[model samples]
Target: AGDPAAGEGKVAACAACHGSDGNATAPIYPNLAGQNVAYLENALKAYRAGERGGGMSMMMTPQAQSLSDEDIADIAAYYGSLTP
Candidate 1:
């Protein structure tokens, strides 16, 4: 699994849109907080693979591309730990 503490430091880029606590800063951005880890991981992996398109795919794909599996897991953990 992943360590929330470790994930915290890796989410600086994500915070701009997703917020530090997994909430979205803008209504157009989806809230990541309180989402399941599996869903978060799968969605990010899909984005990285370019399997998911539309909406923010153009932006998300590039962001996810630089994340390793461990990074994904950690990020998922961090976001999952938050309350919606």
Candidate 2:
């Protein structure tokens, strides 16, 4: 139960890599559009907790660290609502 409208307002930073609509700006970044909300939530949480490790983790970890639970939910909701 996240507010997609509220989530839209919080995605400015993510737009640089993930694009405003959740599609990635480059091939290196995975598109978040239309992803499962649970998956997005788990991934964000893992990144924030430093439990996810990989090439992307180095970048995502720092980005996710500043997000609150509500923020994560909202962001995930926003992305999940988009078309892939």
Candidate 3:
């Protein structure tokens, strides 16, 4: 089973833009549901490290900054577990 508490709080920030169901409201935002874990992790890492450049890169940098490696892994797992 997944950690519901961490999923709730940690995913709260993501829900605003990504939606509670993981479908993005805008075309500019990518939908994360069912995406590959490695892909999600690499994207987050890229955004956090500024290797990926875009409006999302800026918005995600601060959010990703405070996340531990485990936190990222869990989130990737959670989102990847969701259905698109």
Candidate 4:
């Protein structure tokens, strides 16, 4: 919902896994590009809260747990701004 430019830096690490544009290089990683911002935000919060899980959750759970709400917003905005 905020300026997508502000989120660019916040997503550097994410680029390694999700690609700079949020399109994943592998099928194992879910593509984040062009997803709804609200959905991304909620999913991150759910992962952080340990309310979602499976084998794949291990990677996201710890990452999301360390993210602040602002980070979540920025990251969501960044990916949501991209073209899926």
Candidate that scores best on lDDT: 1
Best by TM-score: 1
Model 4: worst 10 consecutive residues (lDDT sum): 1-10
Q: Cα deviation of 81 in candidate 3 (Å)?
A: 0.3
Q: Candidate 4: deviation at residue 3, Å?
A: 3.6
The TM-score values for the models, in the order shown, are 0.97, 0.96, 0.83, 0.90
Candidate 4 residue-wise lDDT at 20: 89
| Model 2 regions lying over 4 Å from their true place | none
Residue pairs in steric clash, candidate 1? Answer: none
Worst 10-residue lDDT window, candidate 3: 1-10
Compared with the true structure, the alpha-carbon lDDT of candidate 1 equals: 0.95
Q: Where is model 3 more than 4 Å wrong at Cα?
A: 1-8
Which stretches in model 1 have alpha-carbon errors above 4 Å?
A: none
Q: List the residue pairs that clash in candidate 3.
A: none
Question: Which tens-of-lDDT digit does each residue in 1-84 have in candidate 4?
Answer: 545787887887778788989888788888999999999999999999999999578888988988889899988998999998
Put the candidates in TM-score order, highest first: 1, 2, 4, 3
lDDT of 3 at 27: 85
Flag the better candidate by TM-score, 1 or 3: 1
Backbone clashes counted, model 3:
0
Each prediction's Cα lDDT score? 0.95, 0.93, 0.77, 0.87
Whole-model lDDT for model 4 versus the true structure?
A: 0.87
